[model samples]
Target: MRQVKHLLADKGSVVHSVSPAAPVIDAIRMMAEHHVGALIVMDGQRLAGIVSERDYARKVVLKGRSSSATPIAEIMTTEVVTVSPEDSVDHCMRLCTERRVRHLPVVDADRVGGVLSIGDLVKAVISEQTEQIEQLQRYIAG
Candidate 1:
């Protein structure tokens, strides 16, 4: 099984974040610009919360809240569950399934390292399985 650190190697450990004081609109723009589904809310160097597309839709749009006027902290998910680079890909999938979250921020020793989405986990698992399958096929053929 592959580790989260290996998966993160291809995708650099750069976390896209916004200040808690930033407006929700700012977060939306950042998400759009980066083509990501979520953004970490940062208070100085500390992780405050995470704002996602679902949060915007459910908290802001559905509630008839204005993005420009509303602070991201108001709609962001505060109690975020994160994963470490040492964790396995299976652990990542389990956390995502159990927590009902698509994205997991990778924290390394109190610092935000990177973010892993469901898609990333899926891709890694598929790649690993493919390699194993190829090895099995070679053994069977030989």
Candidate 2:
């Protein structure tokens, strides 16, 4: 059972964030600069919400909201679901599946430690599967 901690080991604890008061355009720019799909919206020390490309498309573009004038907080999903470092990859996958969300912030003691995406879980699962297959092949040859 691979945990989020294990999967993020090589990636390190890097949580990309922005202020809730920031313009939606700023959030979009940051996401583009980082090449990430989402950004954690922070209100001081608290996790206020999350902004993503999808949010921009649905709320800003489709709804005719101005990205430059609109605050990220206005479009961000406030009911942010989270994961823990010790949480299993399977648990995160299930959460993503049920919530239809792609990203989850890893939290500890109400502090954001890192972020995990569906891609990260998929990569970890694929790596584990490949290792198991190699082990089985070796055993069969022996």
Candidate 3:
């Protein structure tokens, strides 16, 4: 199976993040601009939390909170689950499934490397499977 590093190399390590001090609306706007469902809430060099559209819906809309007034820190998921570059794609899949999180930030030596969505992992797994199937078929024919 491919490692997280390989995935990052293909996808590029562009981490779109927002400051925890920013308002929820700012985070939402940033997400829209980036065409991403979530944004890593960074406090300087620290990974403060993660804010997603789901977080906005559940914490702000459902709770009747004002997005413009609410800070990202208030709604963002602070107990983030992170992975290293060396971690396997399978490991990331398991973590996303068990933790019920859509995003996993890749950390290397306490620094943010990149963010992987569940879609990224699924796509990588499918590609790997497809390649394996083709190899098997070629071997069987020969």
Best by lDDT: 3
Clashes of each: 0, 0, 0
List lDDT for all candidates, in order: 0.94, 0.93, 0.96
- Misplaced by over 4 Å in model 1 are none
Q: In model 3, which runs have C-alpha deviations exceeding 4 angstroms?
A: none
How do the residues 34-83 of candidate 2 rate in per-residue lDDT, one tens digit apiece? Answer: 99999999999999989999999999999988999999989999999999
lDDT of candidate 3? 0.96
What is the total number of backbone clashes in candidate 1? 0
Lowest lDDT sum, 10 consecutive residues, model 3, at 25-34
Descending-lDDT candidate ranking: 3, 1, 2
lDDT tens digits, residue span 1-142, model 3? 9999999999999999999989999989989999999999999999998999999999999999999999999999999999999999999999999999999999999999999999999999999999999999999999
* Residue runs of model 2 more than 4 Å from their true location after superposition: none
Candidate 3 residue pairs that clash: none
